[model samples]
Target: MPAPPIDARSQNARVLGVELCGDDGALLRIMPLEPVGLLRAGRFFMLRRVDGTGPYIPRPFSVYRQYDDGSIEFLIKVMGPGTRSLAQSSTGTELVCVGPLGNGFPELEAGTPKVMVAGGIGSAPFYLLIQQALAGRHGASLAPEDLTLIYGGRKAGFLYDLEAFMDLGVRVLAATDDGSAGFHGNVLDCLHKQWEVGNLPQTVHLLTCGPEPMMEAVAHEAAAKNLECWVSLETYMGCGVGICNGCSLATRPDGPLGAWPVAKACVDGPVFSTSAIEF
Candidate 1:
């Protein structure tokens, strides 16, 4: 099948609403007046507030949810000037956004056992993927029982959208490093326990996004089981269109005869098969 066309637009999007997640953080629901194609799961946008009260460069955010009303959501953690400004903005604020950029998770085959692993805000993109699967979009239909989500965070309060996913009928397993939640360890431990208990299928596909170290650990586990894994990467992007080449990441070449190639995460991918990446 042909690859989906890139859908990047620079528009003034309104802050329709904001749901506070934890202290000093929020989940923003924004709507672009222009009609946009359904943003695939794992894609992101480069957002800059119109007021320009923050940093000059726009920040990249994974699409948390793309609603039918031409609205999209972003899960933001207050970390810097850009995000702080976004978090404090009230409804009706306008944000200049350029995207629906980057590749998304591949459409899974029918009846494939799947596990989605997320670390903190990394859960942003999976919600749309789950929604698509449940709605049978992209010719991929996933039964509720066939999907499991293993989400980890520093504490129970850090795990966002947990109940929302549960309401969608996907089974959820959680872990917190501080032992303040479901499991007493990291999500890797959760995966291990699930495998040990025969809850994990012999053949499984993994979709994950998180800190690089966490994703790397998941990659190693997937490799050990000979499972196919797709990971969504987070990187600093200067230009969401790949013109500045600032989001380049080292990636294994597509063919066998060359050294690892450099791929622009902004354009080449944010979601890549684990085998195609070196780290």
Candidate 2:
């Protein structure tokens, strides 16, 4: 398995600000004491307040966006004490940040179109992916037309930072369980409709991050269509490093990761080819 980046280390960070997003989510921004250079889109960090306000164990969060000034953002759902503490943090609140962990998304192939499916807060990583892809930073440069984002949420209120994603200049489709926004169904239904209408090609690269059930469904769909797909698992991590083994995922017997019975999401990947691990 791969190891954490050599630059990964625990350091102090100070809250820049926290902006409320969607109904129960927040965009928490912090400036790390040390510069972390540029990180791949799907790489993540473990964060916890230095004060005794949240869980003793730090929570793993995907890098939402990184700024030139050594600041990073995390799109967080305020569902638990750990998240709640981060959301309520004021400017200058001290935090422990450990990261640039795990392998990020694989290089994008040229010519093939890419369709990203995101559910709720899972949309976090795609912003940077789209940004990098358009700039030709990830791999072959892709035009805005070559990329599409299908974002879904239980309700419109759950589609956090929808406007910011739309501003990225790529086609952004919204799917809500209720008919509060864009399409009136889940992301899978939205995807099928797009295919049926010929809005998207039959063969395209698929990337998804979301609730386990949603990713599983998307994986099965991609398999049925014989399309390549990758999933960024939102697995819980006790320690965002190989030592804890808290984020182990069972490997597929016939897949690329078959050499090992299991893989660590923190070091090996939070992103994995659908074929490498069983849903």
Best by lDDT: 2
Q: Residues 1-279, candidate 1, lDDT per residue (tens digit)?
A: 112245677778999988888545698989987878977788888887898878878999998888878899899988899898888878999998887788788887777788999998888888888888878884578798888899899888888867887787888898999988788899999999998899987788999998889999999999998899988998888877868878777777762213657777778788888888788
Q: State every prediction's TM-score relative to the real structure.
A: 0.94, 0.98
Model 1 TM-score, 2 decimals: 0.94
Which clashing pairs does model 2 show? none
- The reply for model 1, stretches above 4 Å from the true place, is 1-6, 254-260
- Model 1, residue 49: what's the lDDT? 84
Clashes of each: 0, 0
Q: Give every collision pair in model 1.
A: none
Q: After superposition, how far is residue 126 of candidate 1 from its true place, in Å?
A: 0.5
Query: Could you give candidate 2's per-residue lDDT for residues 1-279 as a string of tens digits?
Result: 467889899999999999999999999999999899788889999999999889989998988888888899999998799999999998999999998787889988779899999999999999999999998889888999999999999999999999999999999999999989999999999999999999999999999999999999999999999999999999989988888889998999899986678999998889999999987
Residue 16 error, candidate 1, Å: 0.9
